[model samples]
Target: MATVFITGESGTGKELCALAIHDNSARATGPFIALNCGAIPQDLLESEVFGHVKGSFTGAISDKPGAATAADGGTLFLDEICEMAPALQTKLLRFLQTSTVQPVGATRPRKVNVRIVCATNQDPLDAVRRGAFREDLYYRLFVVPIHMPPLRDRGEDVIEIAQAALHRFSVEEGRNFAGLSGEVETLFRNHPWPGNVRQLLNVIRHVVVLNDGGLVTLPMLPESLPRSVQPPPAPAAAAPTDPASSGYVLDSLIGRPLAEIERIVIEATLARFDGSVPKAARALELSPSTLYRKIEGWRGA
Candidate 1:
């Protein structure tokens, strides 16, 4: 079976992709094993991947099968693969080459058939260049490379995923939400979802838990997400930067007064959160009353 490499930003569903590969492949009925190489202690990792015999080490009470033996005739998903120690990587490479397992405290190796699927949030080639990962192994598993794009760049998918998550979370919380309000939809579409689908889920969970029912409105959103908020369209006379460029210029600040700059920043932040002063205040680390007083002062001026 061909080894597959999945690379993407964290929370972009690498594991889900790995599972999909296992499910659709020829070994669909066989056991699909997943192992996080980085999470296990380095000393025990060899045994974790290759099994161990009785009394192999201090904790070895009896013969135990590692992920490799456990995943015989199926797929073994190694996550955070680049985090694996260099020394153990050599052994892994050998195992991949021979299609065999040499359990700890065992004198000989046993043949096993299994497909390898690995994932890393970082660039594996870059890791090899930095000498953090084995170059040979990187190329060995680079047969199939899948890169998952960030949520913001996926067009209407943001809204679609949000709607699905909303329904799921609403049912879990025993609340009913028809869908997102138009303003909330625009807010979601315009904002850069840095945390991707996982972030959308938590936000929906917060919305579901706090509110009883109805469409998801701005007021139901968490106050702390203001940093990711995007401001509304500017006036035509302002002549803002091209939307495609999404570039922010700091040159105009050179000649502006400090108070004016602060006001500008506050107003921009407020607009991003749809004029919700409390959410903006929390994002700017200011008290709500302080934000209120500043806005009143700005209007009074």
Candidate 2:
């Protein structure tokens, strides 16, 4: 039951890492308490971390156990530790050093035996230098540091995460989506994903909610996803080449029926041309009226 400090950028899943560690540790059977330092007010934050005695303040109605006391025989996870007030840092440091807590308006310190796990989304070194975080506390909490990489740095994991999220959303929504369409796969793979897995989960849920009864095609995707996030469309020359050579066979349409397949192809083409009907029609070797007719057909189908 070693203390750990997890740090990463926003959306990198620091809290998840903390839970994984706690659940895997020997203290798994004990209580697992968590607190968000940034969510509590500065005035009441100390009382929340280290409980106050009755009549200690305006809101102190009874002697309550703080997060530390609540996890006496287990783990106390402090998330967003960088947001803690400077005054609280000294108190927390003392507790970490002495393994004892002094509740507000209480003279005697109560001993506690608990493992600590702290998480933050900022650079602790920078915080310590800037005086926003205490150096002594930082050293005490930095025993076993674990860093989570951002979505961009995780490479091909993006597509894997999207597929997993899509499957989960499908099961949860009771939707029988054929599978992920090729266009959808490309979009998920190429996106920069600034919001990371959280954003991808939302997009997958949105698609599952709106899907009628087929694969999640490109047309179902949100319009707000940045162009930089979407992969460039397959080259026109590649589409007409031997299907086997290009790895796009009729059977590889992800079990999508012909109508859905055609719609996906046309929508992807339109997007490739930046929504220019004339250019899309010319590129597809169809008349403008024919392109309009195909759109109407797609909508109806």
Candidate 3:
């Protein structure tokens, strides 16, 4: 059977991609088992993958079907395969060479038809060069290579993805949100999402749990976000056609109530300053305390 190898930064959903492959394959109805090699103890890692009979080693109290055997006629997804010890790699390579599984302490190997799909957050070839991963095993499992680009590279897909997460998290947390504000969308688009989709989901979860209804505004975002994320530049203001309009754009403020107009100006300035009220206040020619009082009044109103 052919194998698939996925490489991506952590939180880029490599395992999720592996599962998707398994689900879409001809063996979709069969078992789809996954193992995170790095999470298991080094001593018991072999036994965990290949299984062990009763009393085979310290905690092997009963017979166990390893991932390879249990996933027979289906798929076996090994995450962080690069973390597997070099010594145990031989046994794993042997199993891959022959569609057979030999459990630890077992006398003989048994045949099993399982498609191998493995992933690592690091470069598998680099691991081979560093002697962390076996060269032959790398070649064996790299039949189909999948490189999952980080979220920052995915462009406006982040907007749709965040919205989807927002909707799902909203229902789960019993929070109702219309959607992200235009400023938030611009900020999200400009941000370099180092943590990918997982990070985006976590942020949506945080927002859904903390705030109630309405659009997710810049001020509502966690403070840590503004430091790393910057919003897109606003359109250049139209030249003053009327001397009465001053330097500020008055097109959007014409029919609005004074309170609403003030609120818009304040919030727009806050967004420009990455949600820093201190900086926004300085720009607006008001004391920080005065700005805080006004914002609090708006919240209550």
Candidate 4:
């Protein structure tokens, strides 16, 4: 009765949300089973979810209880639900409606008493519109939908997650170093982390692995981060005497955005290097393709 549906972009902590809900619910003492709908083969996916009788398929030597049955009296998390095939979606809907599952090659339906928590990176509405996801199933699972915000939109959470990961990795790596330095903090704040928390985790793990001592400097950061995050220019004429000159004039000249400024800088560097991506990237100390992708994103914007 305490089912929930969590949705978010990849690396946006969808599974974490599901776990949190399960932990908070009355069934905290019960089992919490998680399934990645996209990881297993489609043929085996159904068997994994709804169990299978002996001789259900080639690999089945004996009857096995799937995740749903195993999670009875607890919570069952279905991750990447959009990745499930259309036919399987219908079958899942049937199970959801009746709280019963018919194992493959089984003659009778077995009642399941587990809270369902579904998650997906893909947009459910879009998937429904495309006829890839069942509209009825969408409405069924969306009863208590929770849209988890991505790390990019969470602003300062990036630093929080990074620090946590760094601490965990540092302890694991047996390094006694302090956290990120001021310079590295600046880079961490500026870099557009498209991969979000997972990328931060990877960077922290990498730093721990590459740490000569306990210090994680800007250089220790991934090439995707440190190389791309250049420092902002120094303020020109700090505290201008003329209010008109300081406020309106400066603001008027640069009305676009900081991203636009970066784009211009990259474009200028590319032109100065005669459109040689490698040379321009080297000059800017960014990956050649990273620079190109930034330009492409700007253009598309």
* lDDT per residue (tens digit) for residues 1-301 in model 2: 5679987667878888888887988888988999999999989989998888999899789998899999998999999999999999999989998899999989899999989999887768778889999998998998998777666546678777877877888888898777777877777777756677788888888888888647878888877875345443442322344545555554557788877777667777777776665677678875444565455444345
* Model 3 score (lDDT): 0.82
RMSD of each: 11.7, 17.1, 16.5, 11.1
Superposed model 4: Cα runs more than 4 Å off: 230-301
Q: Write down the lDDT of every candidate, Cα atoms only.
A: 0.82, 0.79, 0.82, 0.78
* Predicted candidate 1 versus true structure: per-residue lDDT over 1-301, tens digit per residue: 8999987667778888999999998999998999998799989898999999999899999999899999999999999999899888999999999999999999999999999999987767668879999989988998987766566546689899899988888888888889999988888887766677788888988999999989888988999776346543441232134675444536666688999878877877876776666577679986444565566455446
lDDT digits (tens) for residues 1-301 of candidate 4: 8557777667778898899999999989999999999998998999999999999789899999999899999999999998999889999999888999889999999998989999987767778889989999998888887766555445578778888888787788887667778877767777666676777788888888887556678778767664556433322232233666767645654877877657666666666665555577678875433554555466446
What candidate 2 gets wrong by more than 4 Å, as runs, is 227-301
Which pairs of residues collide in candidate 2? none
Q: Among all windows of ten consecutive residues in candidate 2, which has the lowest summed lDDT?
A: 230-239
Question: How big is the RMSD of model 4?
Answer: 11.1
- Which has the higher TM-score value, candidate number 1 or candidate number 2? 1
lDDT for 181 in candidate 1 is 94
Ten contiguous residues minimizing lDDT sum, candidate 4: 231-240
lDDT-best of 2 and 3: 3
TM-score for each of the candidates = 0.74, 0.72, 0.74, 0.75
